[model samples]
Target: MKIRAAVLEKIGAAAPYAQSLPLRVQEVELDPPGPGEVLVRIRAAGLCHSDLSVINGSRPRPTPMVLGHESAGEVVEVANDVRDLRPGDRVVLVFVPSCGGCVPCAEGRPALCEPGAVSNTAGTLLSGERRLHIGETRLNHHTGVSCFAEYAVVSRRSCVKLEADISFAEAALFGCAVLTGVGAVINTARVQAGSTVAVLGLGGVGLNALLAAVASGAREIVAIDLNEDKLALARELGATMTVNASDEGAATAIRTATHGGVDYAFEMAGSIKAMELAYLITRRGGTTITAGLPSPEHKFSFSPVSLVGEERTLRGSYIGSSVPVRDIARYVDLYQRGKLPVNRLMGEQIGLADINAGFDRLATGHSLRDVVVF
Candidate 1:
């Protein structure tokens, strides 16, 4: 099959996202799934900060790569031996696919499966072949799903079908931000009722973290951010208090609001200083979860002696430590039950030609999620 896609021709050159993506509409061949694979016709895709990370060279994606990870669509075709999936099934693509036999998978950590670790990062299929290419240039697609275009060929394990009631636009993010934020609370932190939590940085992930904290029954959810617009949105999403990070006395104010310190703190802005503040404002034994992606050279300070004496837990979570198949459906249910207002998180929906606008908005802290609708 042949389809159109927005290819990142070179690195460091700015894409014309406000008007167009410099996306040359090229037709490429898509091989039928080998072993366990599915071909999806992408409907809607959530524009993630990670996608911008690759284009900006922070993630170091190979030139001329097809970079898209979070998306939702329908199964147009399925490979033989693919059980529980068939053509015409609506599905959400999981960037990380579970093989079910890997060590991590056996330990109930399917998101950490070995196959997805290297392959997903390298922007290739498990078979190590390029299903997307133009002429002799075999472009590397991001993960199993490259939904920046109209269609994506992914592993059957990566596709999770949704109920007829859930909209594709909303379900698109279940593959990334929603899972990362909600899963961190439900599956990773296991936050309990009456606990106090602080979320540093009110971005897409931060907003989800606050909502998850509320869903987990945390009594007080303190939101920290420099954007007043986001802080207002955070409040509606269940943040009991808001902190302006730009203020000189923000740290002291956070401590006061938490009644000395919070039981849990999440750093989602990917700022080095935010991470430090997250650690500082936590109670002696409170947990600190770093959900953001900072620069490689960025570093923060923490006293090892105090860290040990306090018995505090400092851990990093990946995509909310989620099993996509199980958690995506659960989050969809959460949205239906009115516990999560996912639509509020979306600031706008732009076409593929204007994909770069989404990234620009994120860079300037002007938008929540600028979804890509094919």
Candidate 2:
């Protein structure tokens, strides 16, 4: 069947927003679901930082690609071989999990499942091909679902069923930013009550981290951001203190406020300096979690002595150690309890045509998240 989607023809090209260069909306073709797969009619999708990074050439990806990864929808059809998932079921898309019996999944690390290892890079299932097209060229596939389109064919392992009454846009966030941030705090760090915490960057992922720290009973949640608007959003998301990193030395400011350092620091923005600050702000023996995705070309510099003497440990996290089966449900319950503030995270909403505009919002780093509805 044919599908409508936003296609990024190449890197460094402007999305539908400024010029007709790398990104634009075009009608494309889609394949039917394969075995162990389900066809999802996307209700809503999010314009996340990673999507923008790929477009800006920070995160290089195949061109003529369908741009969305964070999305939620109802299952319109499920393959004959697929079980446990049926038509009419509401679900959130996850590109990182393929099999529950894999080595990673068996160790309670579904996010590291091997079979779907490079789904975002390889852009397809085991067949190793995409189902989208622009004119004659095969559009490069991204994260199997490529949910920028109205309909997507995805493996059953890539989706987590959601409860009714939850907005698909909000559910879509659980796929990426929300999962990464909240999972970093709750799943990876396992922050204890009254733990002093600091978060670097107040974008979608960082805001979710801020909220999760609050839910974890953190005593003080210090948020840092170069943009004041994002800092304001961070405060709304449950930050107890805010730091403007534009002109001020953020690390020094955090140190001043916390009277030395915090027990835990999380880096959500993909900045090398910010990652260093996350390390610097941790007290002796304090843990620092790096949740940002730096470009392949970027690298950080740190001294060997700092790691050994400060007794501080720096760790990296991808997708926040999220376990879809258990954590997605737990977060949904938190949302329903009015604790997660899922509604407040909605910065803007646009149709598939306005998809490029949503990308602009993400580039400016102002909103918690922008939704692209099909």
lDDT agreement with native, every candidate: 0.82, 0.82
Query: What tens digits encode model 1's per-residue C-alpha lDDT throughout 7-119?
Result: 87766657445554534446766666677777899999888877777776666766677778889998988778887887878998887877788899999898898987777
Q: Per-residue lDDT of 1-374 in model 2, one digit per residue for the tens?
A: 88888788778865555555456677888877878888899999888888888888898877778888889999999889888888999999985755778789889898887777766677665346566765677876677768888898888888898875787888898888788889999988889999899999877888888889999999999999888987887787788998876655777878888888999999999989888888888887888998898898899888778779988788888889888878888888898898887667777888888767677767777766888876
Clashes of 1: 0
TM-score of each: 0.95, 0.95
Badly placed stretches (over 4 Å) of model 2 are 14-17, 134-136
Off by over 4 Å in 1: 14-26
For every candidate in turn, the CA RMSD to the true structure comes to 1.8, 1.7
Residue pairs with colliding backbones in model 2 are: 13-22
Residue pairs that clash (backbone atoms under 3 angstroms), model 1: none
